[model samples]
Target: MIFLRYILLPIVPIYYLVTWLRNILYDFGIKKSVSYNFPVICVGNLSVGGTGKTPMIEYLINLLKDDYLVATLSRGYKRKTEGFQLANIDATAESIGDEPYQFYNKFKNDILVAVDANRNNGIKQLQLIDKQPDVILLDDAFQHRKVKAGFNILLTTYNNPYFKDIVLPTGNLREPRSGAKRANIIIVTKCPKDLSEAEKNSILKQVDPETNQHVFFSSISYSNSVISSEATKAVEDLEDFTLVTGIANASPLVHFLGDKGLKFEHLNFKDHHDFSKQDIIELNKRALIVTTEKDFMRLKQYESLKDKLFYLPINVVINDEVRINKLIKDFLKIKL
Candidate 1:
């Protein structure tokens, strides 16, 4: 795969040029962009996937849902549906995509979750709803320049910052590193729990944020137990089992589990992999199965695995939570 990416390096410039030109058009207003009067905060990344975007969106939802009628708009990538679909009792991972469905499942009463590839249309649809949202959170729509969000939160992984990456094919970045300028807040996610201030200073130097941009570091916090439809089992009590993952990166979860001295055979799949009959049959053979919460949204739909299937929940633990929350709240106040 590494060799293949290097072999396709020549195509990288073409991809970069196209994406760069698109951003330039949006920047110069040559192409139209719909701006909202209310707060429209976007949590996205320059990379294709795996920068903890879902957790960041959930964090925003939790932060604002108490005082505001918060709503989330996702592109519903790879979903079977079309146009704007408001999540309701009948919503499934297939209908709204895994992340959005997860949001709906968790915050069904507290907030609204909707999906539309056309973000502008999604916002309009949200406005039409009986209970209009005070704030709309756009999930993974950084490159979707049709809708101009009031505040943009760009996420990059601690291991793979966008500054070190180039455009797609050769690198994971969807656009050039210069695109970071558009971000109001840039978060370095999945950092070590004990990351030193010295190292953070080094990273700050590498990032070189603009005067208006705020940089923060965050780490993933995993639940102490694995949850299934029937029961919740403590991580230490679990025996040998099957570890299944359908995400951009599973190494962090794998490492976390390994550190706990747990034993399991891994069945790693590509991000958002649609399980096949054969795959299900194989998974059914395992005595116990553990997976990520996002994957659980889709996997839980299968009746055959309900008894043994389990998932570990994860949340983003930002180093400066109070400050970040204040910044977001301040933005909302100004917009309102």
Candidate 2:
């Protein structure tokens, strides 16, 4: 894999040039980029796979939902549906993609969730709905340059910082490291809870954050194990079972389980992996198969493994809550 990545390094320049040209067109009004009247908070990452975007979005929703009418808009990555569609009473994981569908189901009564390949059009459609939302949260949309967000929160995994990684085929970065400048706030996600000032300074040096941008660090907080939709069997106790995940990054989950004094066997898969029947059969051999909530959304459809699998839900816990809360309050004050 390392050798194959080197073979693809030559095309990095081409990727940079194409991205530059595209942004320049939008900047110069050669291509259109839309901005909505309501405040749009975008939670996205610079890399291709997980940087904990979903949990961060959920955090924001929990923070602001009580005071404001909030809605979530996603590009619906890898969904079967095309154009804009509101997640209705009958929306499933397949219709709006797993992440958005999960959000819809979790916050069905409180939030309006919609998915569209075109970000601007999706926002437009959402605004047209009866009792339009006061604010919109754009999920996994940092690189979607067509929609100008009010506040952009960019996440970079602690293990794979964008500065350390190269573009596309060479590494996981979807855009160049300089793209960090586009964000108003930079969050180093999946950080160790015990990260120190010295380590923080070192990472800041590597990220080279802008003078105007604020940087924050966050870690994953796992909830107690719950029964899988397919299986009615109680997980009994997370400490007794092995953990299995089909997610982009499993380190955070593994660490969380370890902290809880749980001994688990992790089976990691690529991001958004479509679990097969064979995969289910193999997982059944274990006493209990524990997975992330995101994976559970996709795997629940598999009738074969529903009874054997259980999912662990996680939340984003920023270490410096005082500072984060102040920053958000200031931003909302200015926007409001």
Candidate 3:
């Protein structure tokens, strides 16, 4: 597809101009953006997909959930459902999308997760409830200009910063690199665990954050155990298995497992890929199968794949925890 990429290079300027113009409208207030008294923290990326937004959102939830009534709103990507819908007992991966469903499942009875394509309407609905949340976390809503997030935590991968990338139809960026200026905090996701001070300074230099923006680096921290509905097993115990992945990037996971001296075959799928009946049959035939936490949320309901299906959980191991947490807290505390 390298040849196709070269062919698509010509359309890059068109895509770039369209996105740039849209941002200009949002920036200059030609388009109305709602600002709320309650804190709305947006964890999003300039690129199209998988910059560890989910883990970062979860991190913020964990940090503030105890002290604040926390709620999350997402676009509910690829779900069959439409409009504003708060997750309830009837909710499923098909209804509220995999990521939101996963959030509801994991944080049940603790946090509220809702989905809507119309973010402004979703916030209105969330705010209308009698037990209103003290803070709202907008999952993957940076580009949704209707609601101006109080704090924007923009994420990009360590390997490919947005500054070095071109717009869509050519590179993976969803918006122009100048869009990074809107972010209050910028995080370089998926850095090496042992990333050095000097290397981090180099990354910071490349990011070249504005005076108001704070840049941070983080790496993925994998759980020692793989979890299923019925049980959990140490990663080492699963020496051989089929790694079925429906994630944007699987390289970090592959390297992590390989480094642990594990033996496995990978069944790679696109990010947020939906499984078919035939796919289920094939997956059920495997002696053992492991998947991502997000993908597992979508696949777990298949009774055929239950006993063998397990998911590995991961968290973002920020380079400096104290400083980052303080920044988030301080931002939330602004005139509250």
Candidate 4:
């Protein structure tokens, strides 16, 4: 794969030219970039997928939901529908995409959640609702140059930092490393709990964060045990269960389970993999099938295996709470 990437280096110029032109068009007003009246916090990454944007968005929602009317907007990736659609009581994982649907179901009463391919149109639709939200959170939209955001939080996985990676066709970066300058705050997601200050300093040296930009580290926290679908038999005693996950980053989950003294046979798959009937049959061969909450959203459609399947929900916890809280307060105080 390294040799193949080098062979494909010639296309890098073309990619740069195309991105430059698109940015130029928006910069010179040749193309319009729209902004909503509400304060928007954009959680995104320079890579294509799996930077833990969804969990980070959820973290922000949990932090700000009490003081502000929070709304979430996503591009509705891989959904069956199109255009701006407000999530209703009947919204399913298939209708508004798995991530947004999960948010809607979890925070149904307190928050407003919608999905749209066009960010501006989605914000407009949300504004037309009975009670407009004070703050809107845009999920996975760093590269959406057509919509201007008030604050951009760029996330790069700790294992695969963008500073060390090259562009697409050569590396996993969606844009050049310099593109990181656009981010107001940088977060090293999916880091280990024991990552030392010296190691963090080295990473900051590589990232070369500007004086104005704040940097923070975070790790994933999995809930205790898997919740059964029947809501009766709690699988807290997990001595005979198999772990099955289809996320871009499963190492953290695996490590967390190990530290808990829970033994599990893991079946890992590529990110965003659509589970099939045969997959469910093979998974059921174990005593129980365990998975992440994100994967559970996709797997729940398998009515045949609903009784046997269980999920372990996860949350994001910032390592440096003091610095994170201060930065958030400063940002919130700014008049956009």
Candidate number of the best TM-score: 1
| lDDT score for residue 6 of model 1 | 99
Evaluate residue 71 in candidate 3 and report its C-alpha lDDT on the 0 to 100 scale. Answer: 95
CA deviation > 4 Å runs, candidate 2:
227-236, 239-242, 258-265, 281-287, 302-306
lDDT of 4 by residue, 1-336 (tens): 889989999998788677767777877889987865558888999886588998999998888899889999998877888899889987877789888988997898989989999888888898899899888999998888788887889999999999888778777888777778878889999888789999999998998998888899998877765775665344457776788888887887888778778777999988867677788788767777888787787787777768878888778989877787667656766733
What RMSD does model 4 have? 2.3
Ranked by lDDT, the better of candidates 3 and 4 is 3
Which has the greatest lDDT?
1
What residue runs in model 3 are displaced by over 4 Å at the alpha carbon?
none
Candidate 1 lDDT over 90-200, as tens digits, reads 999999999999999999999999999999999999999898999999999998889999999999999999999999898999999999999999999999999999999
Least lDDT summed over 10 consecutive residues: which range in candidate 2? 230-239
In model 4, the runs with Cα more than 4 Å from the true position are: 1-6, 28-30, 232-236, 259-261
Arrange candidates by lDDT, highest first: which order?
1, 3, 4, 2
Off by over 4 Å in 1: none
Q: List the residue pairs that clash in candidate 4.
A: none
C-alpha-based local distance difference test score of model 1 = 0.95
TM-score of each: 0.99, 0.90, 0.98, 0.91
* Model 1: lowest-lDDT 10 consecutive positions: 57-66
lDDT, candidate 3, equals 0.91
